[model samples]
Target: MLEEQLLQRSENKCELCQSGETLKLYAVPPQSANNVDNCIIVCDTCLSQIEKNKETEKNHWRCLTTSMWSELAAVQVVSWRMLNRLSTEGWAVDNLDMMYLDDETLAWAKAAAEDENDEIIEIHKDCNGSPLLAGDSIVLTKSLDVKGSTLNAKLGTVVKNIRLVENNTDQIEGKIEGQVIVILTKYVRKQG
Candidate 1:
């Protein structure tokens, strides 16, 4: 199986930190298929941090200084990506400057990085800076007068199952007073 192959290739240790505890396979992002070239063995700590399931420990990633030079393209790509994520640190910046990747590997790393950045940039937030998703309930923080009509959307109004306006982060659509109206995001707060 792929797990066995990865264990053998990684020498039964985490490829990034060389840890022998609780190791498992980690498929690199923007993955097209599962294979030795697209996966690496990682410990629970590394996996959790990489997946953002746990807080990142900057010192724990210092192992990248050595792993960045692995012969495997998968390892190199992950190392490069991690270094970029920790680029604010002087050591990580130095390591990134020293790391090298072939044209194809560099492209793969950049493609996945860009996808992550795009997702971060597209999130919609409410007046209090809380992230808003489709079908979420929100409360109007300020009363708004509907244009071209007599709709009075009063303050502290609860709008349920709101739909985010497509391609527009500044607005959401909700039914207030039995009429569907576009609401400004800055005037709403996400409801628990």
Candidate 2:
């Protein structure tokens, strides 16, 4: 299995801090594939510290100095990100300056920084401010005209198995009258 392969690659130790206790697979974010190139084996302490907010402990991440030079792209990416976060620390800033990633890897690291800057995770919500999830049915609170078609979705119309639109919190896709259409979240209400 992939887990075993990862375990073998890391020699049954955490890739970051080399701790064998409580090891788990950590997938590098914004990755399309869940393969070894995009995943790293890490211990619980390293995982929790990496995922923590801006107030993370500076001493705990000194291990990055070694992990930053890892052969794996995923490890390098994570190291680059952590180093960037801790750049305010003099040692971290020096490491960031010394670290070298290929163009593609550098782009991936920069993308993570951009995502962190936009900290508000956008979520689809109904007119009543209730959260919407994929596969949840919703009722239209206001009638809407189907763009590029003659179908007029009536008020109180139920849309089943809704899919949230990526990058747009105010829209969702649902089937109405056997045709899939984009419905504004503001005109919908979560169904019981």
Candidate 3:
């Protein structure tokens, strides 16, 4: 439904240049949100150009000075996003102070831009260079001084039943001397 509305608003045209070749929705700068207000119909050419000249954010968004002054929410949001990305430039930084949005609308724009910072599942790599899976026993090849506690994990110590960190791809959770902590997978080797 949002896609359909976007198509209708842009009149099946690329909202940026009024071009009609294969209209697509562009979410300004932050790509996490893909929707009507946060997105505008664009074409493949514009998308690739944006990616190619990513280092030149100022020139890429020179079009926004005119586009930013528009009343459309999509336009405003796109302008806001682009300007924010280009905020490093002097002109874009000045525009941030000039740009104004009501509380409700500004809130919507921000909510749509919140990128997901989720946890990733991680496994121990190992001191011997082996991937440690869950339920596998491992031995610490090197001595480690546990921080913030008085647990001394000695070298050649065997730690059993290692738990892989759910949010990190290169770590495991294991208890040593009644203390639980994160251990780098590369420092642990799988034990039979």
Candidate 4:
């Protein structure tokens, strides 16, 4: 399978940070086919930051200083993109200055950049500022009074398998007392 090939290519380590934990295949953007040339193996941390599921940590990405020199075009393109994303940092800028990409690979990297610029991503977050995803469990930070119902959604209540409201980052849906209700995201905290 494709995953086996990527793991072999990456030596069972994350192609970005060389972390050998929870590795997964990541398809480089702007490419339609899933192949070794367009995909790289990355760890959960790298994958989370890459997909914007978590905030980017500058210290963690210092690995790009070495990964940018990879012979594979996919790894090079990803390193280039991450450098550009973190260009505000002096270290990232320095790395970008030294990194080079071929014309076609540069074009591919820029294509994803343009698409990123054109899209507006809405991420739902908990009261503690942690990103919330569908099927995540949350704890009520404040008690809520259900209108026209006797459901007691008290503080410290645990709501499991919550769903993010479509087109609305400020709200999520969860069941309480056998009834589903929309809860404001600010009143909840994501549970581990």
Residues 1-192, model 1: lDDT tens digits = 999999999899999999999999999988879998999999999999888789889999999999999999989988888887776566876687678899999998888888777232344679976767788999999999998889989999999999989889899999998999999999999998
Off by over 4 Å in 4: 118-192
Writing each residue's lDDT as its tens digit, candidate 2 over 30-103 gives 77778978899999888887777335788978999999999898999989888877654668766876799999
User: What range of 10 consecutive residues in model 2 has the weakest lDDT sum?
Assistant: 116-125
Q: In model 1, where do residues sit more than 4 Å from their true spots?
A: 118-192
Over the stretch 83-160, how does candidate 4's per-residue lDDT look in tens digits? Answer: 888765667766776788999998888889787772324467789767788999999999998878987799999999
Tell me the whole-model lDDT of each prediction, alpha carbons only: 0.88, 0.86, 0.67, 0.89
TM-score of each: 0.61, 0.59, 0.44, 0.61
**3 or 4, greater by TM-score:** 4
The Cα error of candidate 1 at residue 5, in Å, is 0.4
> Cα lDDT of model 2 overall?
0.86
Tell me, what's the RMSD of every candidate? 10.9, 14.7, 14.4, 12.7
lDDT of 3: 0.67
- In the range 115-179, model 3's lDDT, one tens digit per residue, is 42211122235765455567778888778888888788888778887887876757887888878
